[model samples]
Target: MLVDIHNHILPGLDDGPESLEEALLLAETAVANGITHVIATPHHRNRKYDNPALAVKLAAKSLNEELLKQSIPLHILCGQETYFYNEMLQDLDGNLMTLGESGKYLLLELPTNYFPAFIFDILLELQFSGYIPIIVHPERCEFLKRDRQLCYELVRRGALFQINASTLVGENGLTMQRFAKHLIKHNLVHFIASDAHHYKNRPFLIKSAYKYIQKKFSSQYVTYFMENAKHVLEGSVLQPIPPISFKKNSTKH
Candidate 1:
C-alpha cells in the first residue's frame, strides 16, 4: 500500500479540484494508480485560505462511506501544504495548519525563485517547535538553482528534502528534471510526492513515478521511500538514510 504524502484532493476548497466531482475523480485516479493512502494537502498559510480542517474531515468521512458503498477500498488522509511565512509558527501553534496526516511531518513550501535569508533558521525554528519540517520540492526552488550547496547544508541541519515525482520525469523542464535526478542519484531526496494540483495540468498519479524510481535507481530506494512514508504514518521515529555527500560536478557543460 503506497501512501501519497502530498496532494490536493480535498474537494471544493483551496486551489485543488474546483468541485466535489473533480475531487472524486482525483481520488479514483489515485486508487487506480495503486495509492491506498493519500494525504489531501490543501494549500495553507499562504493563500490566506480558510481552515478547511472540518471540511477535510467531512470529505474524508463521506469519501470513505462512498468508497465502501461502491466497494472500492481506498483511504484518503488529511494534511496541509503550508507555505513559508513569518506566521508559520503561529499557525502551527493554532493548529490551523497540520503536517502529514499523522501530524509528525510538516510540508513547507518555499518561494519559487526566492529564498529568505533566514530560511535555515526558520527550519531550525520548526524543529525547535517539535515539528519535523519536510522541505517540499527543493529542486523547484530558485534558491537551490543559485546555490545547490544550500540544499546539502539543509540536510546536514536535520531538514528533509522532498523532490517532485514529475520533475524527475522532466515534466517541468530540463533544468528541474536534471536537478531532481541529481537529488535521487545522490541520496539527498527523502520523499517523492506528486504535489499534484488539478487533473489536467498536474494529474494525481504515482505508479509511473514509482516505476521510474525503481528502474532508474534500485528497488531498495523505492522501498526506502515507502518505509519512510510508513514510519511517518505510524508516528514512529523518522531517521535519515545515512549522510549523503553531494557529487562535485567536474564537467563545465
Candidate 2:
C-alpha cells in the first residue's frame, strides 16, 4: 500500500482546506492519485498555528469517520509538522504527536530560509531522547540550497530528510527540482511526501514523482523511499543509508 507520510489534509487545521468539504475533496484527490494512507500533519507551534497532539488525533478521528461515511477509502493518520523551536523538547516531552502517534519519527520543519545556529544541537538532543528527527523539505531551505554539503552533514548526524513531491516534480521550480535529485542520488533523502495543502494547487503528486524517480534514477531508490515512509508509520527502526559525499565540483550550482 502507498502511504504518504506528510500532508495538511485536515480541515480547519492550518493553511490546508478551509472546511470538511474541502478536506474530503483533498482526500478524494489522494485516493485517485493512488495514496492508500496519508498522515494528516497539521502545523504545530509554528507561531501562527498551534495544533496540540490530542487535538490533531481528534481531528484525524473525525476526518476518518467522515471518510468512512462517504466511503472515500483513504485513511488519515495523525501527525504534526512541528516547526523547530528552542522549547520544542520540553513541549514534546509528553505532548507533540509523532507521525502515526508511534512515538518514533517526528516530522520537523526548520525555518524556511535558514537553519538556526543551534539546529544541530536540537537534532542531536532529539536523537538522544529516542526520537528520530525527519527534516522536511531541506531542498527548499535557502541555507541548505546554498550549502548542499549540509545535507550530508545532517544525515551523518542521524537526521533523515524528506523531500516534497512538488519539488521532485519541478512544481516549485528547476532549482529545487535539481537539489531534490541531488539529495536522492547521494543517498541523503529518506522519504518523498506531498506537503500538500489543497486539491487544486498543492495536490499530491506522489505517483508522478515516483514515476519520475524510476525514470531518472532506479526502481531501487523508489522502493527505498516508499519503504522508509512505511517504516515511519510502523514506528520501526530504519537502518540508515550511509550518505555519499558530493564531489567538490558538484557541491555548488
Candidate 3:
C-alpha cells in the first residue's frame, strides 16, 4: 500500500482542510493518486497551531468514519508535525502522538529559516528515550539547504529524513527540488510524503513524485521509500541503504 507519512488532512485542526467536505475532497484526490493511507499530521506546539494527541486522534477517527460513509477507500491515521522544542520529551510523556501513532517514529519540523543549535542534543535525547525523530521537509529549510553536512550529521546520528513530494517536483522552487534530489541520490532521504494541505495548490503529489524518481533514478529507489514507509508503520527496523557523501561545493545553482 502507498502510505503518506506526513500530511495535514484533518479538518479544522491546522491549516489543512477547513470542513468535512474539504477533507473528503482531499481524501478523494489522495486515493486518485494511488495513496491508500495517510497519517493526519496536524501541527502541534507550533506558535500558530497546537493539536494535542487525543484531539488529533478524535479528529482522525471522525474523518475515517466519514470516509467510510463516503466510500472513499482511504484510511487516516493520527500523527503530529511537531515543531522542535526542549519540552518534546515531556510532551511525549504526556501523550504526544508519533507518526501513525506507532510511538516508534516522530515527525518533526524545524524552522524554515534556520536550524536550532539545540536540535542535535534534542535529537540525541529523543533517540536515547526510544523515539526515532524523522525530520520533516529538510529540503525547504534554508539552513540545511545551505549546509548539506548538517543533514548528513543528523542522519548519521540516527535521525531519519522525510522529504516533501512537492519539493521533488519543484513546486516549492528549484533550489528545494535540487536539494531533494541530492538527498535522494545520496540515500539520505528515508521517506517521501505529500505534506499536502489542500485539494489544489498543495495537493497529493506522491504519484507524480514517485514517477519522477523512477524515471530519474531507478525503480529500486522508489521501492526503497515504499519499504521505509512500511517499516515506519510497522515500527520495525528499516531496510539498510548505505548513504553516500555529498561532494564538496556541489550544491551551487
Candidate 4:
C-alpha cells in the first residue's frame, strides 16, 4: 500500500482543489498513480490559511465518505501542513492537526528563503513534548541549500525530513533534483510524498519517483521510504539513521 504522508486534496482548505469535484479528481489521480492512502494535509496557520484541527478532520471525513460512495479506492486521512510559529507548542492543545491525526508526527513547513534561528529550539521542545517534527521540503529552502549542515543538525535533533516527489523526479528542476538526491545519499530525507495540489498540474508522481530511486539508488532505498511512511501512519516510533555531513567535493550531479 503506497501511503502519501503529505497532500492537499481537501476542498476549500488552502491552495488545493477549489471544490469537492476537483478534490475527487485529484484523489482519482492519486489512485491511478498507485497511492492507496493519503493524508489530507491542508495548510494551517500559514498566515493566509487557517484550517483548524476540527475543521480539517470534518473535511477529511466528508471526502473519505465521498470516495467510498463513488468507489474511488482511495482513503483520506486527517492532517495539516502547519507553518512554524512562535506559539506552535501552545497551539497543540487547541487546533493544530498532526499527520494522520497521530499526535506523534507533525508535518511542519518552514519559510522558503530563510531558516529561522528559533527553529532548532522549537524542534527540541516539540521532541521533548513527545511529537516528532517532520520538516517538509527542506530541499526547496534556500538556507538549507546554502548550509546543508543545518539540515544535518535538524535530523540530529530528532526532526525527520520529507522531500516532494516532484523534486526527486526532476519535475521541479535539475538543481532541486540533485539536492534531493544529495539528501537521500546522506540519509537526510526519510519520506517522499506527492504534495499534490491539482489533478493535472501538480499531480502525484510517487510512482515515478520511487522508480527513479530504485534505478539511481537501490530497491532497498525505495523500501525504506515506503516503510517509513507506513510507520508514520501507524504512529510508530521512528529512530531515523543519523545524517552525515554533506562533503563539498563528495557530491556529483
Query: Per-candidate TM vs. native?
Result: 0.89, 0.96, 0.96, 0.96
Q: Each candidate's lDDT (Cα)? A: 0.74, 0.90, 0.88, 0.90
Give lDDT tens digits, candidate 1, residues 1-253: 7888888877666788887677777777777788888777777757666644666677667767766777666787777777777767766645454544555687888888776778777888878877788889888787676666667778888888888778877788988877777777666788888887777778754777778888888889888888877776666667778655654422111
Sort by lDDT, best first.
Answer: 4, 2, 3, 1
Q: In candidate 3, list every pair of residues with a backbone clash.
A: none
TM-score of 1: 0.89
Candidate 1 displacement at residue 69 in angstroms: 3.1
Q: What shift in Å separates residue 146 of candidate 3 from its native position after superposition? A: 1.1
Clashing pairs in 1: none
| Candidate 2, superposed: residue stretches over 4 Å from native | 247-251
Give the lDDT of residue 33 in candidate 1: 80
Candidate 1: C-alpha RMSD to true structure equals 2.4
Error of 4 at 33 (Å): 1.7
- Tens digits of per-residue lDDT for model 2, 7-67: 9999998999999999999999899889999988999888999899888988999999999
lDDT of model 1 at residue 180? 78
Model 4, 136-208: lDDT tens digits are 9998898888878777888888899999999998988989999989899899999999999999899999999
